[model samples]
Target: MPKILPLFAKALTDSWRSTLGWAVGLTAACMLYLPLYPSIGGSAQMQDLINALPPEMTKALNYDQIASGPGYTQATMFGLLGFLLMSMASIGWGAAAVAGDEESGLLELTLAHSVTRAQVVLERALAMVVRIAFLSVLVFLVVLGLNGPSQLGIDVGHLTGAVLLFAALALFSGTAALFAGALTGRKMYAVAAGAAVAVLGYVFNAVGRQSPDVEWLLNLSPYHWAYGNSPVANGADWGAVAGLFGISAAFIVLGSLALRQRDVGV
Candidate 1:
């Protein structure tokens, strides 16, 4: 390992088992929901069931497009279940990157070495991204394999965009936790910060869909930014993708600055 990135290597090695578990969960979910789409996606009964849902419920659940292959995949796999799983994993990794380490007295030992604080922050963030990308790649491949059989008709390009957006959303929450962890050196606070961002973004997006009057709430929502316009059915909104990545980078900078100012393991 490079002298500057030993922490990064350690992060990945320590989390490999956890990452594998998450990948298994994602693969299982894909196998379960995606293969069933052919039977459930085209039925009159499914359409009637969806139509019976209230407008708010329809939009909030993202079930309005459930009849289509892309829509079904986005609602069940990428947007809902995948998003949930990735967010939790990312937050756990992010929080552990700093606060969890400090609380366990590992961070101070790393800092006592020659590696700078900034390197620790950036490399930790990079490790988190790598693990997330691994899971996302698995999701992409599994869905693509099932595409023909499930008759989803998903465009390869659009599906790529959706999966990337999903990863970015998870990064957003993860980086938020990282920032909080660096700022407070408290895992509980970091977890709450990460969870709060996801919860609030979800609520904001749901409310924003209620009416144009409050639709401005969507503008404030990272969830909307990630999933708006159905990136699975359509090409990704690159602007939103860039925005999420940019924010995550900012979290690294802010986190490094905060960690540098504080006393680790104090």
Candidate 2:
């Protein structure tokens, strides 16, 4: 057999169980929430109820488009639950990839072999990318399978755009954690950094939506980059997609360079 990149292979092998769990849990979440859209969002009574709710509440929760099929899926799954699940899983993996391993002294052992520090950082980052992509694909399949049954009415092309952008957003958070870990060699710091990115992005997007004056805040948010135009309904914004991928790539490069300069397990 050809010799593969050992670190990358090992990372994937070590993470299979947790990755599987995330896939299953997220799939279940999608199934549970999607099937109810017809009864709630598709109902005239529910539309009335939604209209009766305060405008502020609707804006904050992004329910402005909840009465439609694409809007319902965007609101319930991609916007809320899917975002939470993907962010948490990606952040944990990114932080643990380097900082967690170093803390446990496994990184030191790995580096003792023929692996260069740059390889270690880059390969770990690759593992994270793969895992996030895997989960995103799983989500797409689940949603696609239920699209007809649940009457989501999302365009196939648009749904693909939504999932890709969603995955990029999650990857962006994970890379933040990865960068923090490489810079500080501390898992706690990595986790904090990653969580901060997700939370602050969300807050900025939410507050920006509240008024025209503060809408500029959306320019600073990754959440805005992903759902600013409601990709599920409007289709993919390639510019925003490029921005996400660019930022993520930048993080990986910076993190790898920083890791190269640090002494592991010190």
Candidate 3:
């Protein structure tokens, strides 16, 4: 086993509540995608709900790309609901992974071993990946079981893409945690910073959706790219996905470099 696995295991074990909480929350939110099932397509009540939603709200929900309803229910889920789940899961996991350790003074002892700081960060990142994957699979299974064959296939595909998208998001959030761990050495501050990034990203996406003139600003926020280019609506913009990964990798490198220079327990 990797030397870092123990650290990651301990981290996850120590903060099982956050992991479990996000799992439950994301699963519940994903159920909101059930409306995309083909069985519901013909329902008058569901159609009315789609129609009644405001134009700006629908756009924020990415209703234009739905394969059924006025648009796909899964698409609406991706635009807003999916992001909310991801932000909570990824940010919370990131916090527990790094800053949480540092704040507790465990990082100093953990780093005293032969293990490198890079290994610590990399392993924590891996733990986040595993946790998010489990939640994603649970959500996909529930979505598949709830929807019919035709709509089920589409919903599953969209949800799969969203899982990958949020995995990338978790990586990005981990970088922020790494930065915070190396910067203030405070877990709470790290979590707050990550949450700030999420909120700002959400606000930017909301404003950009309301006005085309502000749309260019959307490019600045990672959520905008993921939310706007959802596979359900925009059919998976590989370019944007690549860009997100690239930015995430850059941040990861930045945090690693910062860790190398800083003294632990600062």
Q: Give a tens-digit lDDT track for model 1, residues 1-266.
A: 44657888889999999999999999999999999887786777988988988978988988888899999998888878888899999999999999999999988878888888888998999999999999999999999999999999999999999888999999999999999999999999999999998888888988899899999999989999999889999879999999999999899899999998988888
TM-score of 3: 0.81
In order, what is each prediction's RMSD in angstroms? Answer: 1.2, 1.1, 3.3
Global lDDT of each model? Answer: 0.92, 0.92, 0.66
Residues 1-266, candidate 2, lDDT per residue (tens digit)? 64688788989999999999999989999999899999999999999999999987787778888898899899889998899999999999989988988998888888888888889889989999999999999999999999999998989999999999999999999999999998899999999999999989988988999999999999999998899899999898999889998999999999989999988898
Model 2 per-residue lDDT at 87 = 95
Model 1 vs. true fold: TM: 0.97
Task: Tally clashing residue pairs in candidate 3.
Answer: 2
Superior candidate under lDDT, 1 versus 3? 1
Name the top TM-score candidate. Answer: 2
Report lDDT (Cα) of residue 113, candidate 3: 87
